[model samples]
Target: MSTDDADHPLTRAELRARRAAEEAAAGVEAAAPEDSEPAEPSEAAAPRASTAADAPEAPQVPAVPTADEPVTRSAAPEQVFDDTPGPRRTPNAGSGTSASTADAAPAQAEAEFPDVAPAPAAAAATRVHQEDPPLVPDDAHVEEPPADPQLAPPTDPRLEPPEWQPHPTPAPVARRRRFPLVLGAVIGALVLVVAAFGVITLLQGPRVSSVKIDAQSAIDASGTRMIITASQPLAKVDPKQVSVSPKAPFTVDTSGRNLGIRFTVPLDDDTTYTVTVKDATGTDKQRQSTLQATFQTPKSTIFLLQRNADGDDTIFLTDLGGKNAVPVVQHEKIDDFRATADHLVVATEKGGTSVLLVMDRKGKNQRELKLPGPGFLSNLQVSERGNLVGYTFTDKGISATSGRASILVSQSLTGDGEPQIVTVGDKMPSIAQWAFVPDSSSALFIDFSGALYVEDRSDAKAKPTALGAAQTVEGISRGTYTAIVSRGNDLVELNLADGSEKPLAASTPDFGVPGTIAPFPGGTLRQVATRDATGLPTGQIVTRVDDDGKATKLFSVTGSDAIMQACPSPSGQYSAIVVAPKLVNNPYDQSLLPLPTTMQTHIVDTKTGKELVVLAGFDPSWCAQAPHR
Candidate 1:
């Protein structure tokens, strides 16, 4: 080779032409027999590319070494191959093997130094396609090396590696499983609906399974309550549809499946009341039924005290039925007495002091209660519950001229403690009248000046609550929510809860108002009234009045007969009317208080207006329900 050609190198086009000729020659040689010796090259093998010296320099190709011939390796430009094969071709100017392909230079450098990682397929592909120059032959002379007998011949184009081809996808799956899943869901939903309907069918009807009541007949001024339980859940109750005989004021409660009947007013004694609930529907509302019950209240009996002018006084027990009349006990100069279920409390005057006694129902086991001081007891009363006995007493002090003051006191009949003085603000008032609050340790009192107070006896030092002013305190009702009071000639019911007052009907102008009020069935009151036109009360009668001031006479007397006072039995079935000879003309107060020389007490059935019995007595009262009775 000439020196200029060696230093300037041949143009790329010349080099490429030489490489193509060499490759064609190799193909021809490879087609020859494997053992045949290679033929000598043509004269073209001689150096001839130096004529076009201004052409771009072509990349040098390193001589390939063979096992038999040790050919010297020239330092050639680095060439990098990619993992994914591209179109095969002889080395040319535009191939990524050249340094002129700037983007591929990094990959070629990495290939030259094996320690460096190869460029990724994506980077090599981008350079070859985007930044590569047009294809041109590389015409560098590459000295042939001696062939190695052990090496296999280059792979033929037709015998290239086979590419992977995807297997034919099976025909689209039939989706047979989806049908069964959808069908199962529908069947399950239908089963749930059927179960719900079956459950509803089983509970289609309403039926009353049992009935329970506090009493066959209401035994107290407080009415009775009845509870009815149904077999299944019931719908809302239409209260107006529930039937009650005698048309009394009542309320019905429907909670869950239980039905309740609350009589706001006491039911008539000795009367059969039928409560019928018809057209009652169950929760399912497929069927209706009628439920009914018949109950009768019990008749009432009272204890009468008869005081003799010259001898001992007697306490008698009698019933409105007139069959039961018996004398229980007797005391000398009996001033007042109260009957309880288990015992009888009596007060008698002895000299200047009053004696208090407790006895059993038959007048046996008489026990005297100790007094705080030598005093005379009056206004004696016993609590329905708690077995407490209370009274007002006037202590004469040490001498006749000593200041005489009245004090109120109470003690538990079952306890041994001395009677406690019912006081207001550390002192007892000179009470004109007082009554125990039913079923509680409380009492309502009115001073002589008509100042009403409610004192809780449980705590001795607790201040009493003032309940405004009143002429007289009749009684406490409905636990402590209501108070029956009389102001002048008008009777009023006071709601102690909110301090509201409601007028109660007065029977007649001549009667003023009965000291004793009998709350009967249908929210009606039966009370004693004067038969005469004079307000002084020449004669006596029993009248029934309603809330609107409508009055009806139930029983009456003629001539000079005077009804001193009337008391209703606990169940309101009967009334004990105390009658005395009229004192020509006199006010009702004088006749009711300070028992007359002799008085006749007649027990009469309020419903039938029939006198059951007549007994000689002064003070009459009914006993509360007791274990001994």
Candidate 2:
């Protein structure tokens, strides 16, 4: 409307280029404009000049045309057209105007209209008409999708993502080798198994460790035994493999791992014995070894009690060879006395009551033994192994044979305890003969009726069991199982365990009656068999017998002199026999008691029939395992 509102006019070349671009979008080839002549600019085509005083008001613009309608120039503003072809505008040749120049002429008139500004509605319509579709290059090619085994149908282009891609599969990882690890584990297990097996095998092998003997010196004289212990269970050993240096016959205990070697005969005193066992094997014979033991036997000795007519009775310690007699003790009136390894026990009588005295082996430190009552004591016997002293005592005023008189009682010399009375049925029985069962607290006693019994003196209230009737119990084995008894003219061994009887030895015409029998450590037995002449036995014979009934005559004396008692030495190598002339003789039952005036004791060898010594003593008590050796 004002002079300042005027804008620049469009050129014919610019309008032609815009028409080509529109033609390309409709899939039509745009033709180049023919260059003929230029047309004169119409008055309406020129930009109008206006003065501020003569300026006119602007005119209202027409509404834009939609795609459904065709557009036509109103002769006053720009027109819009639809897709449908209407009238074609050919270039006028006479006017020499091109189609592009004709189109620009109208656009220039729209700028010159002073009262009308270019409408926004017409501009938008022209842009839509000139818009072109996207171009595709002739050389550009689209790649086809690869084939998939399990293919999915194509999705709608509007729903599918623009930048979608296929996922890649990961490569497989390499596997690790396991051969070395498995082999190592197996080898480790085998090593453990082999180690365990070797340990077990070593434990199963047999070995001999050590040997044991009774004593370093003065080994048991009777039959010294050697104990051999093995590390494992043992089998029966070959006799040829066992030997002793002194060349003595021996028996072996093959029932256990511990081997027991027992020499059958007495070993020489003060001698060394070497034993060897080769090829000692286990019970399964899987292992073998050798064993050896050395033992020495000391010289044996004995103690004897000698009575003087006008003085006191003296106790003498002498060797088994009957040499080196030394006075150990002296008492005014000794009825019976016994010696032990360390002390001497004596039964001395004063007035009517009997007293027991204990003193060291040298006769020092004399102490009086407490009596149960003021009574007369007899049959005083000392147990060499148990250190116990046993005696028969009569209560004051009670007669010796009265049934209620003497009772068998025992007391320990080293142990402290009241005197234990050997009682039966709550009362002491009339024990005529009683002795300590060797190496035990029990006693083997014979009543006045000659009925034998065994009572355990450890319990004062223990009852006595009857062991049947016997003529006389010579001696019981240290094992307490076998007893040598006198039955008429035969000396039989009674098995105290089962009450069975077996003949051991008998008196022959040369030997009258078997008086006292003594058992050695190795089951050998020796007895004094008296020979009778003129219906009264006066001669005596000392014979040794074995379990097989083999007899050996050790000593034989023929005359008025008789063998009162035969005491075997502790080593069983010697015998102390009381020899005296028979004062009163009743042939069948001769009294062998010494006349008290003239009695002698003879020490004789049990192996040989040689007499060692004769001493002026009646009762001979060994001081070795017994009272003497």
Put down candidate 2 lDDT per residue, 529-590, tens digits, no spaces. 45345566545677876545567788767866566667776656677777665534413211
Task: Give residue 148's lDDT in candidate 1 (0 to 100).
Answer: 33
The residue-by-residue lDDT of candidate 1 on 427-517, one tens digit each, is 6667887777765667788888788888777666767788888887664554335777887777788876667898875554334456456
Best model per TM-score: 2
Give the TM-score (vs. native) of candidate 1: 0.55
Q: Tally clashes: model 1.
A: 8
| Model 1: per-residue Cα lDDT at residue 126 | 27
The alpha-carbon lDDT assigned to residue 53 of candidate 2 equals: 25
